[model samples]
Target: MALRHECIQRASTIGSNLKDGGPRRRWAAMLVLTSALAAPGLAFAQDDGALDIVVTAQKRSERLQEVPIAITALSADALDNAGATNFSGVVNMTPTLNSVPYVTNSDTLVLTMRGQGEADADKITKDGSVGIYVDGFHRSRAQGALFDLADVERVEVLRGPQGTLYGRNTTGGAVNIISKKPSGELGGKAQLTYGNRDYVRLLTSLDLPAWNNLSAKFSFLYSEKDGYVKNIGPSNDYGELGNLAGRVALRWDAGTGFVADYQFDKGRTRSTPPYYVNPSLVGVVPGYSDDPYQTYRPVDLPVSKTDYDNHGLTLSWDASDLVTLKSLTGYRELKAHSFTDLTVALGLPTFPYNIDQERRLKNREFTQEFQLVGHSGDGRLEYTIGLFYLDERGSNALFQNLTLPFGMGTVVTDRRVRATSESKAAFAQLTWTPPVLDDRLELTFGGRYTDDKKTAARSIVVNGFAVETDIRNRQTFNRFNPAFTANMKWTQDLTTYAKFSTGYRAGGSSEGGGDFTLTYGPEKITSYEVGLKSQWLDSHLLFNLAAYHNKIKGLQIDIPVDAFDPSIVDTQNIGSGTIQGLEVELIARPARDVSLTASYALVDTKVDTLLVPVGSAFDPAVNPGSPFAVGQNIADRFVIPFASRNTLTLSGDATFLRVGDNSFSAHADFRYQSGFYGAAGAGPAVPGREFYHAPSRETVNGRITWARALEGGSEMRVSLWGQNIFDTRNKQFIIAQGDTINGFVSQAAPYSEPATYGVELGFKF
Candidate 1:
């Protein structure tokens, strides 16, 4: 069959037929959409074993080779092959991509792509540089993402600016997670795992038999582990992990060209922050060891706890042969209480007990979207039109204790804050394959217009005295993002394309603690890309390459509002920059069950313009945000965090040792990254503070599995896997803090996770 329609609807699917003219245009779109509804959905192609992979990169089901973009799709089997059970593990070595877990191992994620990402994901009011979508529902806050990937169908990572199809906050790109739906059958799978450091994990899934066109599914996971670093002090070990989560899904097929899917997920997580060990204090502190895996236990700290719930419902109807109407509704909420200890005070002695830091955080968001997908009767033109709305509410109560010098009394500060936003947008994209040039050329144009209204309110009380009753501010921003693309097919297996796109990251009120209320505007990105997709060796070898350049405007620079306390931030539009990158990926299959893959990305970031914030002369008594008295521009001195100059991934998989109904397979992978900086050194404040540098590092992971085919359409498998098998010790972060009150500097550098090996047993029927 030729590529004749936007969707691959089965002929058995019965849909409405209509007339011509504008009516013809409308009916054509419906026909193309109803074709897709004949089945529940199309699964994106995974890594390895397949040349022509299916993808929904363009909102419509299409071949991955035909999509004119840079994307890496991984299916469930691919994940299992790589022994990936967490979000960070799934994208560990993706080209042009960087994924980092939060300091406290919470549910938040910092995803940097093509050298663009959010530096401070801890701030609740700020938006991430990349966009994350789950089953057609956009996630507003990055704080409550899926810390563990369970029962996921596939994960697609799209590089470069993707604003035309996805909305704002996609200056870098997007990560689309498509989960498994109810299969309308009685089947299930379960796995149990045990690893080093006393780790224990369990995962299970169940599918109920279909009844009256209704299907239901359930999944649960429990994971816990001891900290990698030993705690020698009064508190528990550092970097501990404990998590429990559950998922429920329901699908209703009306059999009248309509489908409804409802999904709900809840997770409870508890963990301690990564143990901080500073080289400067390695020997000076009492019982401080230079080894990254050992540390003098903290004096007084509390374990972090977080609970979140996410729910989404999708309703779709084949209104006619020319158009399909779809609606998505999503609701997510998070409640968390955490404590952070920024000091390593092993030598200091205090008689009084006081609280160091505490936070009670909460956030909730609701989103609704309506979409119309269609194509022309001749299948020459395809289009998508959508309207989106999102409302978010966030609240936080912060408290901290500071001890004065010379045995003085402790001072306590309290602040309560609330932030909310309401956003509305309309977006459209159209693709036309003209009759000229044998219908091999495709031209596309897309655009989105968005309006956002945001509000921030803060109330402060100092030692039982109300300083600021309530300081509230509201701001509104509007913008239009556009994209253009030209793609061509030179042969059945060769395609090339070029694209230009734009996106923006929303901004809001800055938490400046003084009398003034500060706010910043949205930051924007302009990106250009060229890509190639080709196949050779008679479908045994596949190659994909892409190059892109991105320019950023109104860079949102976050600075510490308080010198002693680094958690509070004052955001500003202080700089602009440009980023260019190149990505190359290749996969080769020498036999029916053997594959080799290589993916590499090279990126460079440069500042176009960076200005010093206008401020009064630095007076230690009056000003704390920064000490720079405005002078010459220092654009080149600015820092970019979580960006590696060079990244490479190499992997191989083979299935051998075959028996009558059993076979063994082995998988191995190596990941390498050049030097990358952590957070910018205190936002250009303290003396000699700039980029928090971390040296280059590499890791190796491997897994071996044995599978047996059973009667009655069932299978059983056992796998042994190990991550960081070499136990390489490498620093992953360097957070610098200027302790002016203590008259010294504190450096917090934490190393990557140690080696871990586990065995998993799974069965499906």
Candidate 2:
């Protein structure tokens, strides 16, 4: 099928069809989508002997097929087998998840799920639409979402609104990371990897023997590599990485069915920013060409740094045979600094746009949660209730200077902003499997009430004068979200469900000039979802399909007043929109030693209305250069940017041979994404205006591994891996005609890591 045409037709026809046909049309569309995905060669499959995946998606241990929600769970072994080192790599294999790094920093991640999310991930004042939780504790800031993934047990990605269970900024979805717990067994493992560009890595972990009902584990990782793009200036190469992280966990099983766990983790990263290149300046710098991977700079290299620490404690008690109580507490701190050279060319002493900028963010957060889980004696009724609280303080400081000729007066802008937020929530959920229909029908109902408060202050200084100082404001928001789900089993291996849920993001104040009135209201979303999970052919194949439609209100958008000025952007609450999508996941083991996984997502987004203040920055009467006008309805012209319409992934693994105590396996994965707008929102597409459009791209990664038994009861393994094997020049961000007046600048993703091959050695006991 022509994905581009399909995407365009789907997006263009949604509003009218949805409005006319309503729910009936929506359901009919879902049926068509299901039929389209379940073509001739793709049969449904499920939990066979070797493919049983267990997940805690509903805050309880259950088989993946039995869960009614749309979720994808990947075990640690799967990640290791796929050569996935970070979340960005994992995203390529998942459906309906996109990770876009902010332009200012590579460490910050802007997460999107099902075409509903924010693009300005670097801002400390803005919250992410997708929520991230580590060991049941929320990570409020996107700055810390890209840390190391060592000592992880499994990761679960839940699509749609997770309002009732995970209520903080989860309008899009939630990502839950479960870390490896302490085991009462004496074991250890070590791994060493070496690759091109002087890349080197060492990972080690140890588990102590149990004693006095206590168990412990420790893990460490150190990785360093030279940049992939050479620099023509004094700075180091671009795309370099230097990271160190460690973790320690202890578990104590007290008497009377009580268990306590404590964990502490710390990590740090130091690297250079992504290289920017201007194709027009082909022969300007030494060794520079028209290639996007090469760059020319005359100034010293810029630095990007990140440091973080996390501590968590959890206590669980088996109050009785049918009930359990659990408490989770956590504290986290993060500090990050990033430097970028906005000028893509060697700043000639005569040029006027030689912008040198630096930004720093500091954050401290604390969270607490208590949960009670219980079930009836007959096991027909299950319930869970929880209370959550979070407190956070964050500060952002930005400095920009125009480095012009010595005689010319220098222009400088300095801004500092601080924000403090507190949130409290109480949630409960109940599930019942009635005696009717042979216990094959189930229903779930849940609700959550959240109260959020925020206080913010900003100070802006220009040149030697303070333009604004000590502007303070406070705002509060309260909301109640509800969720309902009904599941029916048509057969022993097939189950279908329908779910409805609501989610919201708290309101916030602007971080610019000292204006207390610059505030935006909260954004809300109501979602309707239908899904099918099935397994067939004796559990040899598994297929899962999900379709959803989301109605959003009061969507918040950040508008850039000037392309070159970051401090002048305005945030406002726009009107309403609709996002609909279809996702398909399939896994099959056609043979005993071969397995394959495939996934696809088709997302269609539309802006139903755009309401703006008459004299706002988006109003044409006040700003003729803007995309919107004062009185003219611009909803039809507004399209949700930064969301890809079509996404596909396919991966396969095969163990073709085994010689005595030696075995060899091969694995590979491929991903494709359709074109999408690069700018935050729909912008002026005129010839002279600056607009960005990310082009379509495809990437492939592969690895081959050989394992052998060692003298002791251990194993030794060696593997060779390559990412972006074809060296595809896929641009992640682009600014058109950046060197020309009203032009854009660009950066190939630092995480892309073009065309690299590496080998790793591992030993386990």
Candidate 3:
């Protein structure tokens, strides 16, 4: 008990690790800021040693530090330095990002910013709260979010609600993955990486010089790795992964006032699910001692597969000095099928059928957007107006049958759900710098008017009872969201701002209930934030800080119809709460050869109200003495899932030795995240159904690189990297039930990955 309290106390201290007025703050802000700004925007670099980053977070290219919203931006070098092959690889360094990779399988890489994101038990028909964009193309679903980011330029993470100007309305935040464009130069790079567990990856890219005003680029990558968990039979071990991805891009400049860019990409992945283990039977597996990575493999547990293709085209024309017209068109398609064996990990070999549980997801998305961006003639005012449209169609299917112990009987389920969404919106943002205080004070106004038309159809059969068969329903929702901000440049090196914004997650009919038209209202949030961006010590340091509070209404909450199964469930707008947090980032170059960056965040969630009416199943009056925990006031004890209280990251790099054309450098990072609740359901605080809290875990990652200039104009490099060097195996995911009788389809929980090390060889010309 004392240890638990100590962990909680350490995690709750958000302001202690932060020193007062340290020079380190600007380093991360600049590390994140300058790269984002330097790659795309126009920012002044006072010192050659200092980073100059630019960004388009506010629809305009400017210095990241000067932007009003809090942004964490890093370049490809930073990503490669940290060995971040995908977004989840960078989560430890980002204080605000929270991800759940073991949601259903590895295919579902769900990410949420600021405590609110995609829920593990979220309905298949629901959309994620956080918006992810690839070159301004919004990805509506989280199914293919983990695809390898092959040739990327820079990544920007916006930490506040940006629904006012974005094409899609996401309540949490946004992540923009920007890939490098055609450089019109003849150059390419090939690389190979080999690691333990038979891990191997190959990547190559080529850029062709411009010809007849046209430039092109091509890139491809292949990666595969054997799983860590030892299986009992001839089947492959759990957590194995294999993937292939490729991309082609073209650019055209007519020498007129117009330019066009087109890109097409495809990716496919095959992987085994994480080996889940029942704590009670951990040491019973063959050939391995008690451990999270050891499990009794179910025979013929086929691997899961996910495939996707994307096409995007953008056209821009300079109509006049004051206005530039642009159009963005995109089409994306994805298909995924996954199989999981639940009973095998729980020592239920007699239960036939290998669980026979699988989920298939198919989705298609089309998006079109038009934008007019320019500045006023006087140069004191700027504006961006856009028209956006998105069409999404998706189908989700689940098939499973579970055999339980203690004569609990066999439960079967075969469900299919179809949903279609058409969204249209018009948005405008205007910023004006008055003639006061030397044009240092700025006022910005932005708003978005959106209309969403959605429809859903469901076919459900539980234990051959045909609860709902081909039931369909539709609904339309509209809202006008607005934002306002005031920025005051206290000095050339520091700026302070305050803003208010509102965002919402659209609600639709569950399309269930057999013949009844059941529906829920949209989840809404109103947020306020204040922050400062500063650069000091001759631009060698950058620091950014922000604090925000959000009030939520009609928050979406879900529960199962039967306590033993989650396949069939109901979603309601029952609970309301508040989420508030503080974020700090810093970066500094203390010596000419050394660099350091750090970031920390503190999030607190409070449930203020939960409406459990007389007829609701959660009400004590509705069941009196069932497993519902009679007389329990859920709102008083409810907790948000996977929302860690404290997160801290520290990174440092030193180029201690450099001789002529040869150099050597080493990089290292430390990461810490407090314990958090991880459960698939939020129920009436009943026994064996209450929220599960995972203990806090921390680890360190390091890398060392050697580089030399080749005989030609090419460069050769070698790198050694390792993750989780100490191999802390903490249970980050768990759902337990002490049975008197009934059992669900899955009763096993997953643990964290073990330590891993790798080596890379690369040649660039």
Clashes of each: 10, 10, 16
By the lDDT metric, which is better: model 2 or model 3?
Answer: 2
State the displacement of the C-alpha of residue 291, model 3, in Å, after optimal TM-score superposition: 3.4
Clashing residue pairs for model 2:
45-535, 45-541, 45-542, 46-535, 46-541, 235-301, 735-744, 736-744, 737-743, 738-744
Most lDDT-accurate candidate = 2
Sort every candidate by lDDT, greatest first: 2, 3, 1
Worst 10 residues of 2 by lDDT: 34-43
Off by over 4 Å in 3: 1-47, 121-123, 281-290, 344-356, 406-409, 463-465, 509-517, 613-616, 619-633, 680-691, 711-713, 738-747
Each candidate structure's TM-score, on Cα atoms with residue i matched to residue i, is 0.88, 0.89, 0.89
* TM-score, cand. 1: 0.88
lDDT agreement of model 3 with the native: 0.73
lDDT of 3 by residue, 70-185 (tens): 88886777777777787676566677887766645665665768888756432456767788999999988887667776878888888877786778988889988899999999
How far does residue 33 in candidate 2 sit from its true spot (Å)? 23
Q: Between candidates 1 and 3, which one is better according to lDDT?
A: 3
lDDT of 2 by residue, 445-558 (tens): 999998999988888889979987878778899999999999998887899999989998887866652244578889999999999999866776678999999999987866
| lDDT tens digits by residue: candidate 1, 1-765 | 121121123211211111111343234323323222110111313344345567788888788788998998877777777887877776674757776666544455677888888776656667888788889788766664537778888888888877667644468888888999999999999988898888888899999999999999999999998878776667867677788999999999999999999999999887776665665555555555556666655456677788889999999998888789999999998888876654453112222122356778899989998889999899898999988899999987878776554566666778888989898999999999999999999999999998989898888877788888779888899989999999999998999999999998887766543533667789899999999999876665677899998888988865554544554556776678888888877765545566656677888877677666554212334465434445445564455667887776666567868998999988777666776766532233334443255666666777889999999989999999899887877775465554222222545567778899988898988
